[model samples]
Target: MPEAIHIRPDAARPIDVAVGILMRPDGDVLLGQRPAGKPYAGYWEFPGGKVEPGEDIFVALQREFVEELGIEVLSGEPWCCVEHVYEHAHVRLYFYICRAWRGEPQSLEGQAFAWQGAFGVSPLLPATIPLLEWLDRVRYAQPS
Candidate 1:
């Protein structure tokens, strides 16, 4: 039989995470598969990571991109915030719209990458679903 672990209410607090919604001029956005062994492994999501203590959201975004994608985020702006509760952790996701970067994104981590249109991808992380809706609204709102 497996041991049952008890978690303190305070210890189950929400994690603060930064996510980058990298958009190309052509309207496609970048999504990366969560690498093996990570929580929600194989699920597609905007690439980003936990905000280290004392780190600003932009700084966290930049650091995460460099570490995970090997690219320097040249320009990014705050987009949206979403909170999601999963079985393992509750997370507050700070999303940024990254339209410019210094290097072509290559998955330095062992994750696959995709450039997808608004409704094209599937099996996205639960937290990512709302962000996709926001993207669709913003992308289509522009004059055609």
Candidate 2:
């Protein structure tokens, strides 16, 4: 057997860009709050995590669903990408519109999760608010 060598982080902290699944069912979608003791604690946002090297964005989203949320991403399409500059580091978010899936949703990360209608959830984190607005179709895919 060969050992799987781990690659170091881009920065001392890490540089992670990931996908957030807007899992839609019956015309609504699910949102999860970042757990306490974490970077974006108490902020309601889509469920996802860090992207690994050599990994494609879509595959990362599917894997994240299985690992972090204990669900399967039946299908999704590329939605939008967002870049946020936090004090600690920068993150580029790739969001997708989950078109289909099965099984009940669970928060494997032990964070709070919610299902809200398009444009329903609010008071979310500044980073994710734009995504919510996109789900709401508040504006076109890109700002005019």
Best by TM-score: 1
Which parts of model 2 have CA positions greater than 4 angstroms off?
Answer: 1-16, 118-122, 138-144
On the 0 to 100 scale, the lDDT of residue 113 in model 1 is 93
Model 1 over residues 110-139: C-alpha lDDT tens digits? 899998885566688988886666688765
Error of 2 at 89 (Å): 1.9
Clashes of each: 0, 0
Worst 10 residues of 1 by lDDT: 135-144
Question: Residue 142 of model 1: what lDDT?
Answer: 36
Alpha carbon lDDT at 85, candidate 2: 69
Give candidate 1's whole-model lDDT: 0.85
Clashing pairs in 1: none
Instruction: Estimate every model's Cα lDDT from 0 to 1.
Output: 0.85, 0.71
